[model samples]
Target: MISDDIGKRILCLSFNQTNTCLAVGSTKGFRIIRLEDSKTIIKRDEDSQSNFPGGFSLVIPVFSTPLICLVGSSSNARYPFNTVYFWDDYKTSSEAEIHFRFEVKNALVRRDRIVIILEKITYVYVLNNLQALASIETISNEKGVGAISYDKDIFVLVSLSKEPGHLRMENFYTNEVKSGQVHENPITYVAIDFIGSIGASASAQGTIIRVFDCAKLEVLYELRRGSRPAEISSIAFSPNQNYLVVTSNKSTVHAWKLEKKEKSYTSMISRYLPNYFQYSRSLGKLSLKTEIDLTCPYSNITGPKACFFTENEFFIACLDGNIHKCSIHPVSGEISIAQSLQYFGLSSVSVVERGRTWNNIE
Candidate 1:
């Protein structure tokens, strides 16, 4: 059962790295929900009693590891708002913890680093020891989101630029900074590919999504979510970087194919296309601006959460406590709803793109 409703309210829902396991946090507590029998299976009934810090229990599962974590929130919670805790193995109690001086705005985990976004600051910490490595005073809005390139290689934080409406990205390792006036409208969402080489952002205009190659500090592509304004819930790239999945308030998900000419007219003197080529079709741009709905034939919701399960299959979660498995046909890009599980929480959903089996069974 997708029982995020077990406790008082659904706080957070995330899939572990392998997608075989899911972590559901509720106001009362949390539990590890195993995806089996084409449904959400809870291990124990007592797992619902939780002591998570009140407010936004934005718990996130560690990729490639066995950790279910959350940055405690709200101003009056028992756990300080600035603390980050590891609910190791979906236990009610946290097994390991870290603290910060400022409240966490958002956080992202990539390989060995934990990128924490604070109201005015961003901190990077080593995962093993929770040691502070770097801190940058950010001009980013308080709700800025962080993106990690697949392979957990590069980390990108969308921070406000000093010059208004512009955004800057500061590297945690190289300390290199890339800045540009990306959009006139406020940035609505941010995304990065596996290597952190490519980044995408959608402006408040909501109709357009822009992709950037941070290495060159230039835009490589623009995608239209719709002609009308819509709230973007999420933007994720498949592991292979072949497809980009986008979810919006319209209760629809769109996956756009990344265009790169595989068959060059001639090997020599071939033109080079960065990711956002506005030029030739053979360049690094998305050949077609068209996007097919991954959530076709499905009704709308407040905002559906979605992520890729495989190159051809993806999953969508709606507030109605339902999860739909959607798949794309090879070559044709035809989308079909393969299955629907009516037992799930109405919260953000995560799928473990890679599997590593480790669970706490006490």
Candidate 2:
């Protein structure tokens, strides 16, 4: 049975490389859970100053490394938020800490680097030595709290744009920016596959989700989330890239296939019609404007969040302290609850691999 209050408010969730373990952050604190069942592997207490000020607003595990972690919270807290702490075992003591004059809002970690996202600016650090690598100023959102990461050196985030919604992408090793405006509206959600070749983005309008190839900066396809003005809470691509899963303020989710469909003469006609298929000048490709659902384990509330549990399954968490495991049918793309667990108040959930079970306390 799922608890009525696993976490009061889940602020953020992150996954490691293999997606076998999960890092959950909430009002209670932060916890590492094994996905085979809801077994807690480790926990950090929120009341302890050594652990955090308020609670963990964000938590990210270093890829495949159990001992390393990055967290963010209130700046005035005894622990403080202006620095990204590199905890060895517990939050109280850190093997290495990266200090910032600005408060850190979110963070993302890769194999060799960790991205520290502040309210106004973003910083990249080499994971091995915690060296400041690069800075990006156009980012408009928090961090990729639940965003995906590639094994290699490419990443994406929402960027501030005056004309249209823009995504600022970075090839960290090359330090080059690949940006595009897939939607005319404000971009709300973005995702990249496990291999890092494909990318997806959604908007406040919430009607259309644009999928693109990162290498060419080309719009590949669109996954329709909803027709109304609903905010998308989560978007994830399967490990195999066969399906893309999305959850939102509503109760249902939409999973679209990446496989190409048969082209119609209308599709061919739209290709020649620039206005019909909004073409990107930089990449010379057409944008699909198709807007389009399946249900989840939990009933819809103010917001429901989700991530890929397997290549075919997904989990949605609700505020009432319940995590529902839902599986999508291969032929029809329908979702049904496999089981409901007694976990409570899980604000965010991500799949991770290995992490330390020790605490931040002395």
Candidate 3:
């Protein structure tokens, strides 16, 4: 789940699979709303300090007998130094409490446990009863990990820095290290498909989207989207693994088809410029009105964030506190708006499986 507000100042998102939920810590606090009844269940203040305000950089849920949420906090804060908070959401107290804390740069939840990626040191921690059951340190100097996905027994790590991007896969469970593949740009986001055999990566430049094989750790295809120079903020795989949705600072949403026969994607310009005359003249020699419809029925909001409910259904969050749901046709490459809702006091928006539950700390 990806959460963002109309102001572009905050983004709260969580990632979960099977029975676990990963929630990003927020400065304002964490709130869990039930999808079935739309009721607020949990709200807790994320620990913070004067130097580094505390908030979750990322949240990943792990599937086990008892559910666990893997939480990572920003490095700048004083709450803890590059730590991973192991949380059991089933607890009843207001202080949900941290089951375990490990000094790690980032963490991701897998089917059986959690993987913590550090700047210079990499470690994988398996949990049992909210305790670190086993820890494995990998041999690599990884600066940062942006995204992670697992398939079969293999785990893929996407590392980024000022240097070129690197992708590494390892089977610590069985003890195997796949060769590290490198790219020229920094990796922004990564997602593995439902089958876990295929995966994709978006770059900080927002110009390249690379598709790779999780089993082989190989780049099979690369799609170059050259319109925006900003970083790719979010990327998601459609539920059925037929299309990929990507969003960025440009406030535009793009859907790319994965099928070879219908290998194409469409760009939906949901929002149009408010000042047509100014935008027209900025185009230099090109006639803006003739080149693009200035009066099209588009959104006035900017900084749009998006996610998928299914492969064919998606929702986009606007800066104006509105969420627009659209239905996408994979074969036809068409997008149609299905519904819109205005959520009050929602600065950022993210979606998870509808029936998950949360208990408040206070």
Candidate 3 least-lDDT 10 residues: 279-288
Per-residue lDDT of model 1, residues 1-362, tens digit only: 12232223344455554455555544444455544444444322243434442323455677645575665435226666587777665454578787777776666776587777776677778888888987767565555555654355555554556554567777655668888987787775777765777777777666777777866558776766667788776676666767766776666677677775455555233446442332222111111111221111111122566667677677665544456677666676666677777543332332321242111111
Tell me each candidate's TM-score: 0.72, 0.76, 0.63
Identify the candidate with maximal lDDT: 2
Candidate 2 lDDT score relative to the true structure:
0.58
Report the lDDT tens digits of candidate 2 across residue range 1-362: 11222213455555555665567655445677665586666766444534453445556666545654655544225446676667665444568777778767667677776777665566777778878877777545543322435566455433343334776666544455676677887676677776667777777887777887765557887655645677777677777888777666665566676677678877677757755253221111111121111111221123555668688786665444456677777876666778877443222332222231211111
- By descending lDDT, how would the candidates be arranged? 2, 1, 3
- Backbone clashes under 3 angstroms, per model: 14, 23, 12
Which regions in candidate 3 have their CA more than 4 angstroms from the true location?
A: 1-11, 18-24, 34-39, 45-55, 62-78, 92-105, 129-146, 150-163, 172-176, 180-182, 261-306, 316-323, 342-362
Whole-model lDDT per candidate = 0.57, 0.58, 0.47
RMSD, every candidate, angstroms: 9.6, 9.6, 12.0
